[model samples]
Target: MLPLSLLNTAKGHPILVELKTGAHCHPKSPTLCEYIDQRSTVDRVTYNGHLHSCDNWMNINLHEVICTSAGGDKFWRLAEVYIRGSTIKYLRLPDQIIDIVREDREFRERRETLSGNGTGRGGRGGGSGGRGGYNNNRGGRGGGGAPRGRGGFSKQQN
Candidate 1:
C-alpha cells in the first residue's frame, strides 16, 4: 500500500515518526538523536525542538522536537505538527491497523472471486479481440476495409 494510504489508515491512532537527520534538533551542537515524536495524528508537522508547555502536556511543532528520552520516559503532547514529507524516515503504526488492512484485502479478494472478475484483468471474451475474445472484425484498420498498400491507394488500371 502507498504511504499516504497507510497514513490515512493510521488516523486517530498513535504514531512514532523518525526523521532523516538531526538538523531539526539543537542547531549549535547537532546530535543525531532518535527523536521519536509520538503524536496522535500525522498532520501539519514541524521539526523544531522548542517545547511548548500545556497543562501536564507539551505542545510541540515538528520544528521543535528535541531528543526523545533514552529510557522512553519523556512524551511530548503535540498539538499539530507539519514535517516535510522528505524528512520522514519511517512511521510506526499501531498493530490494529494491520488487521484492518488484511481484512480489507481479504474482502476485496472474495468479492473478485464471487464476481468472476479476478484481478479486474480482461476475462473470458472481454477484451478487444486481442486475447480470449473472438475477433469480431469490429476494430483495427478502419473496420475490415481493404488493407492499405504502401502507395497510399490501389492504382486502378483501366
Candidate 2:
C-alpha cells in the first residue's frame, strides 16, 4: 500500500514511476499495461515525470513525461499522462524530499517555541494542534518550556 501523505508531498516533484512489468515484482504472474508493453516481452518501462496531482485512488497526473523502454534502450516523451495507481509497481522520489519534509516540521517546531502564547495549538488561530500538542495549563505568553504546537503558525511579536 502507498502512503498517500508521502505521495502528496511528491507533488510538483520529479518521480520515476515504474509500471507493473510482466509480473516481475509479483514473481507468480506478470501484469503489464498494454499501452506500454505492447511488445509483450519488454522487461521494464519507466516514466520520468513531474507529478502534477493525484486522487484518492492513488491515480496520478504527470506532466513532461519521458518514457523509457526496457534496459534503458529506447525513449519517448509525452507532454502529460495519467496513470492508474493499480498499474504502478513503485514510485521513486528524490532524495531531498525527506529533508524537505523534515525542514518544514522543524520550522513549525521552532515557530512553536517562539509563539510564546500558551493559548492552544496554533494558539492564536485555534487550529488542530499537531501531534499531541494539547496542554491545558501553562503560565502565559513568553514563558519557558512552551508546549510544542501551542504557538505553531502564530506570528511572533518581538
Candidate 3:
C-alpha cells in the first residue's frame, strides 16, 4: 500500500518537509501533490516539526517547527506553520511509523473480535441459509416449515 496514503499515522510525529521553490521565506513544507514545476536551481528549505494534520492536497499543518536553510547553517524556530501542498518537494516520515501502524491494526482487530464481527464481513459469516445451523436468515425459524418431498415439491406414487 502507499505509505503517504495513511497520513494519520504520522500525526503528532516529527516530519521533515522540504519545499520545491525554497523561496527562503520558510514556514513551508510537505504537500500531497503528484508533481512540482520548478525550473530554478533547487534550494532546500527544510521544515522540521510534528504534524498536526494534512489534507488531500498535501498541505500540512505542523507545530513547534524549526526551519533549516539549504547550507545547513541557518535555523529558525516557529510555533506553528501551514505548508502549502503546491510548494512541497517531499516529506520525511519517522522510521518507527511502521510499528505504530501495526499497533493500530491490532487494536482494531481486537475491537472487531469483541463485537463478534471477527469475519470482517460486517458480522455476516455465510450466505443464504438453506436449512440453518448458524447464519439462518430466518431468524431462528425452521426453514419456513416446508415438508420433505419425494422428488419435486409434490408427493410421488408408490
Candidate 4:
C-alpha cells in the first residue's frame, strides 16, 4: 500500500483514483469512493503522476484528470494518484515499482500453493513479466531501447 504523504500531492479538482485493495478488501462490493462514504475507508488518490492527496481541489490542476468517486461522502485522503492528462493519456509509473508489486503478488500465490491452498490442481498460467528481456539485447527480436544506444529507434533485422 502507498504511504499517506504521496496522496497529499493531489489536492485539486480532476483527480484520477486507482483503488487498489488488499486481499481482504472487496473489489466487487461498493467502490472505494462508496466504501469510504459508506464505511469510511481510506482511499488512495493518484493525480499528475503523484501519489498524494491535496488539501483542496483548487490547489492542483483540475483539467487533467478523469476523476471518479465511488461513494458520496468521506474524508479519505489521497493515497496514490497518477495524472495523465484531461483523461490520463498514460500513467508513467516507475518500472521498478510495477515490478515489485507484481513480484509480491506472485510470491503470495506461490505461498498459497505451497501451503496446499489449492485442491492439488494445476494453477493458472504464471510469469506475466512484461518487457523483461528488452533491456538486454539491443538488436535481434527483443529490441526495445535502441540500436546505437543514443535514444533512437534501431533498424529491425529481417
TM-score of each: 0.46, 0.57, 0.56, 0.26
Which has the better TM-score: candidate 3, or candidate 4?
A: 3
Reference-based lDDT, residue 92, model 2: 92
- Which residues of candidate 1, in runs, are more than 4 Å off? 23-76, 122-134, 137-158
Clashes of each: 19, 3, 2, 27
| Lowest lDDT 10-residue stretch of candidate 3 | 143-152
Q: Indicate the TM-score of model 1.
A: 0.46
Q: What overall lDDT goes with each candidate model? A: 0.43, 0.64, 0.62, 0.36
Better of 1 and 3 by TM-score: 3
Please give the distance, in angstroms, between residue 91's alpha carbon in candidate 4 and its true position after superposition.
0.9
Per residue, candidate 2 scores C-alpha lDDT tens digits across 20-124 of 865222222123244444575655568899999998888898899887777786676777778888888888988787777777778877886686444343333
Question: Model 4 has how many clashing residue pairs?
Answer: 27
> Once model 1 is optimally superposed onto the true structure by TM-score, how far is the C-alpha of residue 98 displaced, in angstroms?
1.0
User: Which digits, one per residue and each the tens of the lDDT, describe model 1 over residues 71-137?
Assistant: 4544554334545455556656678877887788789889866764323643232212232212332
- Candidate 1 residue 128 Cα shift, in angstroms, is 12
